[model samples]
Target: MGVQDLLKNLLDWVANLGFWGPAAFIIIYNLATILFVPGSLLTLGAGVVFGVFWGSIYVSIGSVIGATFAFLIGRYFARDWVAKKLENHEQFKAIDQAVGQEGWKIVGLTRLSPIFPFNLLNYAFGLTNVSLKDYFLASWIGMLPGTILYVYVGSLIGSLAQLGMGERSRTSVEWLFYGMGLIVTVIVTIYITKIAQNALNQKIK
Candidate 1:
């Protein structure tokens, strides 16, 4: 089948699962992060289907769980092999040194911004000396704001779609509200990251 047909079939399957379908999808999507699927897509989809509040919660939880799992896999199963394979590469060594010195900070920064890919971090962090508790806590806290923002944006888009095209021009105020919301989200994320970094540094020292 064509890509559109495949997507439709998947959507149908998701619809059949009802509320549980989205939750399941979020979980599975997170679990498969190593496959290079952007977790934001799942969060956005959740928001589109379930509204902002529930969608944000679902994505946050799924991300935490998936990240934890990936960390564990990296710690126990993949670290040695990966290190051996990449040992000759200077860039890889630099990353390793950076993680060793400030793993939590690196993870936190990456999570807060869209700079590095989340899936890669999930696996790469495992190769570091960061404790499981530290990894999970940092991952959850760092990822929360972005997850919420994307989910809420998805919810807004869904509302707009439901209202149809003509309503968009008529609902200029609503669009303004969304723009304001986006601005607020960006500010909040930056503030939260700063606070988190300070707290992490204190703890590390």
Candidate 2:
């Protein structure tokens, strides 16, 4: 079978598994994030299938769980190996030190900015000396806004289609909702990031 046919079959199989199917997929997807899957695809798919609010919640939870797993694995299993891999790099060493001193703030900033690949950040963080609690908390809070924004965009698309409006009108509404979601996401992200940054700076000082 062709690739599209295989994907169709896989989706059908997932559908046949009922609600448990998505839940199971989510667990596996989050785990796969550890292996460097670009998490945005999964998040977007979740939004498409589940609508915004619930999709965002599920994505958030799964991401946090996956990130925590990565962090723990790095801390206990692979820190030495990973460190050795980066030992010759001055910038990597600087980042490692920064993470040690201000890990939560840096995590929050990266989460807000979309400057780095999410999976890479997760694994790189895993190799850092940042505390598990700080890592989890920063990731959980930092990721929430973007998750909600993407999911809401998907939900808006679905909702517009369900409304049976004309194609042009639906497109317009989708853009409108997307713009609104973007504004909200940015505002909330900034506020939360500031809070986390302030707290981290105080703690570091």
Candidate 3:
């Protein structure tokens, strides 16, 4: 089956679970993330299924747990393999070493801007010297803003889909609120990304 079909089927199954649906989806989505699922897609699913507040909460919990699990897998199980690969990668080597020197700040910056693939970086950081506590803390905090923004967008999209675009936007308030939210999210994301870029540059140097 196509990927979208597979994803929809999975969501449908999860929804059939009733009161436990959100919990089930949280676990499934967390695993999906570590398996290299596009976070944006899963995030939108969260928003669609749970609305903004619950979606954000569930995503936050699931993301933190999944990231920690991925980090541990990298640190304890895959370090040797990952290390061998990094031996030939100067940029990655630089990041590993810089993470050693810069600690959680490096972790925070990467989580914010994500120079590396999200799934890979989770495992990659496992080989670094940063402590699990620091890594988890920084990751949770760094991932927060982006998570909320995506979930909120998902909620908005859900509203549009349910109400129909024509009906929803027939009034100016809905359009205005969504427009303002989009603008704010874009501005915040840009600002944070610029900071992360600077942080990465400094760490590289």
Candidate 4:
């Protein structure tokens, strides 16, 4: 199914599950990451289902666990397969070398900047010299900003949907803050990415 349909179905199913919904969402997110599913929709869906704070927390937990799992799979279970798959990825080779020297910094910068594909990078990192502890720590911390921004946007969308249906009320102040927050997040993410990209280039070179 498409992302929206999958998200809609998941929302409908989990909406009635009370406290268990978050757990289920995390598991689903973990599976999606391993399955190579694009996580943008799932992350946004978390905000639509939960709110900003809870959604960010849930997504962070799920994504970190998923990344760790993928890393283990690449390192222990499918090292040869992953190695063969990434052999031609010259960029990954540079990253592997860079990681040997920089360890978690490389992982953190790549995560912050979106310099590499998230799901693939999870597996690819296993081939590097970075420790699993460092990888997990860096991934969680680096991914937080993007997660919060996306979740906030999704929460806003959810609010707008309710507003359209006349099921909820929103104040002008709320809208103002939402707009400002989004703009600030976008700008901050851009600035961070630029710095990360520059630093990563120097390291990889």
Worst 10 residues of 1 by lDDT: 159-168
Work out the TM-score per prediction. Answer: 0.67, 0.67, 0.74, 0.77
**Count of steric clashes across candidates, in order:** 0, 0, 0, 0
Q: Where is model 4 more than 4 Å wrong at Cα?
A: 159-205
> Cα miss at 19, model 4 (Å)?
1.5
Q: Name the best candidate (by TM-score).
A: 4
Instruction: Give the C-alpha miss distance for residue 201 in model 2, angstroms.
Output: 18
After superposing candidate 3, which stretches have Cα over 4 Å from the reference?
84-90, 159-205
Error (Å) of candidate 3 at residue 134 is 0.5
What's the lDDT of the predicted structure labeled candidate 4?
Answer: 0.78
Error of 1 at 23 (Å): 4.0
lDDT of 4 by residue, 1-205 (tens): 7655765677667766898999998998899888788788777677888989999999999999999999999999989989998999876766776676668877886776544689999999988779999999999998887788777766876632232233345557546655765665465455545554666787689
Q: Higher-lDDT candidate among 2 and 4?
A: 4
User: Against the hidden true structure, what lDDT does model 1 obtain?
Assistant: 0.65
lDDT of 2 by residue, 69-159 (tens): 8777666788786667556855444455566656687677566655445765676788876778888899899888778766665555553
Which RMSD does model 3 reach against the true structure? Answer: 6.0
3 against 4, candidate with superior lDDT:
4
List the global CA lDDT of all models: 0.65, 0.64, 0.72, 0.78
lDDT of 3 by residue, 17-79 (tens): 889988888898779767767676667667777888998998888888888888998888887
| Residue range 45-141, candidate 1, lDDT tens digits | 6677678887788778878888888777777888886567556754334444555666676567557655445776687778878788888888889
